[model samples]
Target: MRGLFEGGRICEEFSAGYYGVCAVGGLISAGTTHLAITPFDVLKVHMQVNPVKYNSISTCFTTLLREQGPSAFWRGRGGKFFGYGIQGACRFGLYEYFKKVYSNLLVDQNRSTIFFLSSASAEVIANVALSPFEAVKVRVQAQPWFAKGLIDGFPKLYASEGLFGFYRGLVPLWGRNLPFSMIMFSTFEHSVNFLYRNVIQRRKEDCSKAQQLGVTCLAGYAAGSVGSIISNPADNIVASLYNRKASSLTLAVKKIGLMNLFTRSLSIRIMLVGPVVTLQWLFYDTIKVLSGLPTSGDDRTDVEQIRTT
Candidate 1:
């Protein structure tokens, strides 16, 4: 019995070490993915905040291309790496970590509502930790002349904004990310779980890994769509509020309106922000499952197997 317990301990420890390594590697991959698509992120934020100015993603892209040159797409890779990389690490790592914590703490995870809350809670932690980084990323992305890439962007943003600058969009960011992450993590978790338990498991063990990944993404996309709609107003506000002068988050929220924030926001022009967020989530979650990373967990260690695959 003692030997079995010792073996289990060894296994768990081994799993944890592997999980960390996989998470870092996955983070790098995820970071690269973010860098690759940053132009779209910028475009989307612009559409949300300055829609009248830019109109749509296509128009925004064309304007940047025509005005700044085609290479303008790579304008903010510097801050993108720093800000987005940290966000990816915190989000993926914490989410996996929290899911397990939630599951262990609340054994009734079988309950759908519990799963929703669990994911939401985990995402909130992630959003808070990543907010400062996001502020940096947003400013860098929005400002065309700051620097060419991540290496220069960090110091520049820090130099100009100081710590406060790095956190420029934090309040609205929290408002947006809180619900986005919550709904995203929870919905993604439930979606993956449902797929794994029902569609994949019931279908057959003979199902290919690709089949599983497809199902996981379908689940992820579904949840992402809902989160995008629910939080569109806040998301748009974050992008807009950061560019303007503001004393505090509350002030910004006040500007946007504490109640019925979506309808009140002048900055967010995307009346259809939900579909956009949905698209973004679909892409994001598809990447997660395809990479064999954890969909949601309270502890990062349990995801070693998922990550390694």
Candidate 2:
């Protein structure tokens, strides 16, 4: 069993050429999903910060359309694409690399442990990698009144904040992303396997592309929703933090924690972000499943870590 994972066969067998292919696919998959669901993201944030002004996602979207026009949804489209594109790319790429690295660092295991640790380690690495991009994306996305589409948000951020600006929300970004990534990937992989092996075993092997796709979508959605709830507040903090010009991470944390920090308005945040995340996960995992991206595999144990320059 140990030798099996260590063999080159697993990599070759993944059907994506090598692990790197999955990373590339994951990047593309995540990017398209982010683009599609960004409008909800915009609305979610608004709801979190200013709930009274907006009642619901639909109502908020409609109001934004009425006042600012439909184009409002794309307020920070540029930052999202490039920022999140790079993020997704790095995330998937690094996750594969890190999973292998961490797995090998220790020793062998069954598929379950492998799936959990590899994914969790990979997620941490990926989240760390994404800090700067996330900072940029949040900054871009937060500014409600950017004249052009989301792309313009990048130039605006650069013009206003300089290099450091791109990294503004990194601390909070990590706070949100690290846990989110760990939970999301681990759960998604496990969920898919659980369903296929037990709940839906009979059809998986003979599954048509469409059938596999359907299962993947469900797994992805479940994992994504779980991830979103775990990750939202950190996300909000990252978004809020990036827009500021704080001197340091400590300063930023202090700033964000000005009121109660950990105890800060939970009920409101949930009411706003909960629905958005639910939909966001549904849409996001759907993209991954459809695109044939890297997912947690059957071997639920340790994954060998590999690195790329």
Candidate 3:
């Protein structure tokens, strides 16, 4: 176990093992945090699919509680857990891998560009892993009678709609997650750099573990909130499509209206995403630290210098 965690063993020199560890960290962070917010997710989906019936967050909460009882809040949690776990693993792991690859490839090595490209590339694949589960999760959440959770939901969806059923919303999922990830990773990386350079007034390596983690939390929240706002329209469309609220994306947008797409349920989503993203970065960095790796986005020049030496 110690060997697994040690720098020179499993995580040696940022090889495949190191990326694997990062992937594990991503899974733990995303899976647990998303699972913990099942109730709020249910509310968000209802508000998106049937805003008239569900209405505001408070109204939706009360309606679901009254109509379906406590279990209603946890609908689709299994899909949420496994779906996000796989997505997170691929997202974080591939981001690291691509970041390194892009860094080495680009002669100019522009950090922001690297951040955006790496995250976008990574999310493309990650969302593929997440889409099937996301389809099940949305159907289960928006219409509880569809199935119990991922267990029954998966088979029922398959039987009813076949393999295509699992991927029906893949386009909307991409529409939502792609920009979300690009904004998230780039914002997080820039925010971390800014905080350390401006507010913290020190190098990241000089900070204690607690302080580094605090920076991670702050940066992650900022990124998540921004990403949530940018992605909300696509998110609503995903829910609308999966819930059969609309036949297609264009039709869904028309039914949802332009303004409602951006505004409705936006606040609740920001609230949910902010802390979830914060905790994810905190957890991911914590695991990296535990594995004797530096916190992410910490002094790229320094790392490069070390590699050269």
lDDT of each model, Cα atoms only?
0.56, 0.57, 0.87
Candidate 3 per-residue lDDT over residues 209-256, each given as its tens digit: 788889899999999999999999999899988888888889999999
* Model 3 deviation from the true structure expressed as Cα RMSD, one decimal place: 3.4
Instruction: List candidate 1 segments past 4 Å from native.
Output: 1-15, 109-125, 196-206, 245-247, 250-309
| Tens digits of per-residue lDDT for model 1, 1-309 | 111222332223225643453345435644665666666676765554455667656688888788777666665565556555666565655555555566678875454455566445655665566666566566656676665555676687678778776666666777776777777666766666566555555331234545644655576567656766677677766776666634566665666455535643322323233333344344444444344433222222223333454
Candidate 2 regions exceeding 4 Å error are 1-17, 108-113, 124-133, 144-152, 202-211, 245-296, 299-309
- Writing each residue's lDDT as its tens digit, candidate 2 over 1-309 gives 111123323344234454555566556656665676667667765554444676666677787789777766675555556556666666765666666666677565654466556666656556555665565555545555543443565566678778776666666767787777777777767776677666655434355545555666677667766776677657646645665634555765565564434333444445533443344344443444444433334423212111110
> Which structure is stronger by TM-score: 2 or 3?
3
- TM-score sort, best first: 3, 1, 2
* Candidate 3 or 1, higher lDDT: 3
By TM-score, the best candidate is 3
- My TM-score estimates for the predictions, one after another, are 0.70, 0.70, 0.93
User: What's the lDDT for candidate 3?
Assistant: 0.87
**What TM-score, to 2 decimals, does candidate 1 have?**
0.70
Write out the backbone clash pairs for model 3.
none
